[model samples]
Target: MSLCFFDYGYSLLLRHTTEEAIATCIEAIEPARAALTSQLRNTVINDLIEGLTKHDWFTELDIADEPPPVRFSLREWINQAKEVQATVFIAEKQEALVKESWEVLKQNIPENSLRFFTLVLEIAPAVKNMFSFLKDSDEIPQNNPKLKAHAVKVFKMTCESAIQLRQKGEVVVSDTTLKYLGSVHVEKGVIDPHFQVVKEALMRTVKEAVGDQKWSDEMGSAWGEAYDQLAAAIKTEMKQQLEAAPKSSSD
Candidate 1:
């Protein structure tokens, strides 16, 4: 089941219940005359009437006049994709953290290996925002073919990213393990040091190769710039709100 279906079904159910409850309340108003204040009764009736009359009030609800269903569905798809991607990312990071600990604990570990491991850890927190847009979707993509395509793209990117990360992880582990092995001149530490590098590299490598299609350096830079703009706007708005706050009695 997709997250979209779940959200839409839940919303529809809420709307239906609200309508039923309003009807029941209105019908019971005569019997329980004092249950609702006069203003409350008027407000409830007006809202119910407006909801009931909305369709009739609109003479033409053509496709152009209505919200684009495609855009709505696409947004839903993106949300679901982001949620699942985020889960994958956090899980990967957890595994990497364990690997990092192992590498740090192991004897004769080189600083070069530490550098790669640290680089891998640095990106985990950065990718946390990627999942903000994704939500659990239960809606099947039948209503929108574009959403289906987007789902396919997201899945493909995930798989590709996983494979590439695995390959790179192997390379990093092999290189680091050989260094550690040469330094210790022992065989027992091979598993600890090598596997740690492999695991951590695997987690960090995918920030570029996986998740969203446009998460490359260029796109990432643009996103950072946009985030700065958004933060500045929010700060300004907050400052304005503070300035407009009611003056204290001391004033």
Candidate 2:
């Protein structure tokens, strides 16, 4: 970007942040967090922060009593992005740790799938009503082929979406996958609480798959955060579908 644009943007940010100026400047760029590629967004924000010290007006925004040093959080723009859950910036190390554990998780997918569904049922037996495969049989859901297949498919989709999240800067799955998720949840009458139950079960299942020796609080957090992002994407689609459906007669 041109230096002129950078200076202008930085001035706008200063005004909005310190001066509490009108939100027009900040509002205009909010969409950039979701629309712009991560690399571009990072480049723009980083350039703005890095050039702060070079500006003659740097002292104006600086709050430190001492000179020659400046301290701030991960940059205000980044904080803003995180607040909006848009283009979230994941550290390289955290991203790598998740990627590594994900590979190990794959080895346990079959066994883990059984355990995941078992936990889901155990956590909320009411959830069983939503599973069509369980309607015709007395067999344990974990043992049923249909349950196993569906469980594994869902586990893969949810976890895989989480895995790629670091690169995508958001939870994004194939449009086909999104459509399937949106439709099934609508058909099953799934709600936010159901998603929470499944999320807890998924967390417990992942912990078991990784085993005690390998599992850590950080891993739990990473998986939980990723799952929330994925769930939010699905819910957004579901909301749209529900809104678009023909309204019932209440007139």
Candidate 3:
């Protein structure tokens, strides 16, 4: 049988074995499960069962004859479910923050892009050399369509990463994507340190767009953590690429 079907059957069995107490446990988890896909929902349910089994809570149940191999104690199971419920609650909050923040962000993409590029230049003048396409442009970086497009893409990716991170089971950005991004940067002569500058510029743009009233500490921390994770993944890939590359003859 599919794990989904098994999960449902297990829950029903729990209701019979533990009575109304199981209802309270399910109640605590229903909100979290409501937004998840069936696959992820089943994963969480299975994880909860695994956790209970690891704690040997199932052995404590006094079912007549043999306990159906997956028994659970009401008190212990509820406690374990509460822990998973807390994670789901936090992910929901983070997802809300990302969505609301992006709404504020998309309102003025061009302006924010300008701010990001300007900050990037200010913090790391050397980065200007990397953007050879803008070398001869007399127009300001913010007004440049190419620069604006690049900024928008970066912000969009960041928003997507945050959303993925908030999803059940931490399904954030994929390793393949991160590796490709890192490889592209490596070809562009971009190093791991450059990501810090980019992150700072991006955060500054977000703050400017959202303003202090809407940009709470939680939002800042969430974005900060998300960026850090992306940067780390990219840097890891970059490091691997460098290590695998052929050494120079001079070396």
* Best by the TM-score measure: 2
Clashes of 3: 0
lDDT tens per residue, model 1, 21-98: 756644554223322333354455455445545555433333455556323333344454556556544444433433
Query: Where does candidate 1 stray beyond 4 Å?
Result: 1-214
The C-alpha RMSD in Å for every predicted model, in order, reads 25.3, 12.9, 11.7
Best by lDDT, which number?
2
Q: Lowest summed-lDDT stretch of 10 residues in model 1?
A: 164-173
Cα-based lDDT for every prediction? 0.38, 0.75, 0.72
Candidate 1 or 3, higher TM-score?
A: 3
Q: Estimated TM-score per prediction?
A: 0.18, 0.66, 0.63
**Model 3, range 1-251, lDDT digits (tens) per residue?**
45465469557868576757777766666544554454475577678766765774355665567656655566667677777777666666666786688788778776766677788888887777777667775545556778778767766776677656765434366778877787888899887678889888878887888888898877877777778877777777888998999998883
TM-score for predicted model 2 compared with the true structure: 0.66
Residue 107 of model 2 has an lDDT of: 90
Model 3: lDDT of residue 119 = 88
Candidate 2: list runs displaced more than 4 Å: 1-57, 61-90, 136-139
